[model samples]
Target: MSASETNSFRAGRIVQLLFGIAVAAAFMLPIVWLVAGSFRPGSEIFTSLDPLSIGTFIPPRPTLANFGSALGGAFRTGLINSIVVAACTVVVGLLVCAAAAFALSAMQWRGREVVFAIIVFSFLIPEEVVALPLSAIFAQGGLQNTYTALIVPFVGNGIVIFLMRQFFLAIPRSLIEAAQVDGAGWLRIFLQIFLPLSRPALIAAGVILFNAQWQAYLWPLLVTTRADMLLAPITLGLMVGEHTSDYGQIFAASTILSFIPAVVLLGFQRFFTDSVAMSGVKE
Candidate 1:
């Protein structure tokens, strides 16, 4: 390459790197502020308006009192509840969605397209629009104030089923035919053949479902009135506002709660990414 061309290419690379770093810093600024504020004194959270100002990146003295208060107070109960509810939702959702996806993809049942269409169409109905009627049903069914109230309604998500079905559809028909020739029953084929091949879809679905249920606020708040029945992290962080506007404790609880999903994602991120990539590979 000519000298001018080489210099131009180098300049382009520098510009791209600079732009990427600027965007990354922009996104990280809020998280940085939140972490820094969590360490600051309760009184200083709002008082120190310019946390990123010169020489203010680090606090003078960081204390764990906010974390202590958050854990000691109602925040703790809320966090536990959130975990339980989210776990239940994830388990139930995965099982139901996987089963439905398997049937739709692997079986030669009649009216399958119509059934799948109905499932997809249900996604158009907003949750808020149905909350009132759902609440009434929960009350009538004696599910109110119970963990069932938080979990049952979310057991079958349309998006999850659709995604799983799409993934399952991509699996080669030859694989299923081979399994059938081996005298594998539908259940056996699903468990041994389809499930193994559909791991990426499963992981993708699990991550999305888990995150959705983890951060769920409106449904839980509406269904359960009692504080003791509330879910984990989110509930705890929310109650922080009700109990008192303790920004320090609130930020601390939020920071800790935020880490739960982050930790989960970090642990399984590789699997999730690989699965997504494999899903795009045509058989």
Candidate 2:
């Protein structure tokens, strides 16, 4: 290429980099403000709010009191509850969804399409539309105010099944056929061949599912009325809003709560990214 063309190319690349950085900063500004505000004194949070102020960038007098309160106060219990619920949701959702996806993808049963359609249709039904009926069912089943109420209702996640099915469908049919030819039952074929190969899809589904369960608010609030039963992390952060409007504490707790999912996402980011990339590569 000519010298002028090369220089122009470099300049264009630099401009693109700058534009990308600016877009990223724009997206991250709210989170940056939250973290910064959390460190600031409550008085300074609302009054002296300049997101980019270097003077306010670092906490003037950093205190762990907000974190302390968050850990020891209502947040502590709520955080615990959230952990329990989210853990249960992730484990149970993965198991149930995986089994359902396997069956849908591998088997040829009567009315299979109809069943899959119904499950997908459930996703279209807004949570708010079903909340009232679900609450009543929980009340009748004596699951109200219990962990069962929180975990059981969401165990069979349609979206998880859908994603898993899509991934399973992409697997080589020869592997499944070979397993079957070797006298392997459906269970053995799924366990030895399908499950092992579907790690990427599982990881991707897990990350999405965990995030959903972690941040869940409305259903938990409806079912568990007792403070002791409150889930940790998100629930606790929310309770901070109700008990005391301490913005600093709220921000601190929220910032801390935010990190849990981000950390979780980051931990599996490579796997999730690889899964997406691999999905695009033709078999």
Off by over 4 Å in 2: 49-51, 233-244, 280-283
Tens digits of per-residue lDDT for model 2, 1-283:
9999999999999999999999999998788778887777777777755757765656677777777766778887787777788888888888889999999988889999999999999988888888888888898988888989988877888888888887888887788788888899999988888888889888888887888888777777778877788776445446545555788778787887889999999899888777666655545
Query: Each model's TM-score, in the order given?
Result: 0.91, 0.92
TM-score of 1: 0.91
Per-residue error (Å), model 1, residue 248: 0.8
lDDT per residue (tens digit) for residues 1-283 in model 1: 9999999999999999999999999998888777777787777876755756843456679888888888897788888887888788888898899999999987998999999999999988888888888898898998888998998878898989998887887788888899889898988988888887777678778877888888777788778878799776446546545456888887888888888998888877887677656656666
lDDT of 1: 0.82
Q: Which pairs clash inside model 2?
A: 78-231, 78-232, 79-232, 79-233, 80-232, 81-231, 81-232, 82-231, 82-232
Segments in model 1 whose C-alpha atoms lie over 4 Å from true places: 49-51, 54-56, 237-244
The clash number for model 2 is: 9
Model 2 residue 88 CA deviation in Å: 1.5
Model 2 reaches what TM-score against the true structure?
Answer: 0.92
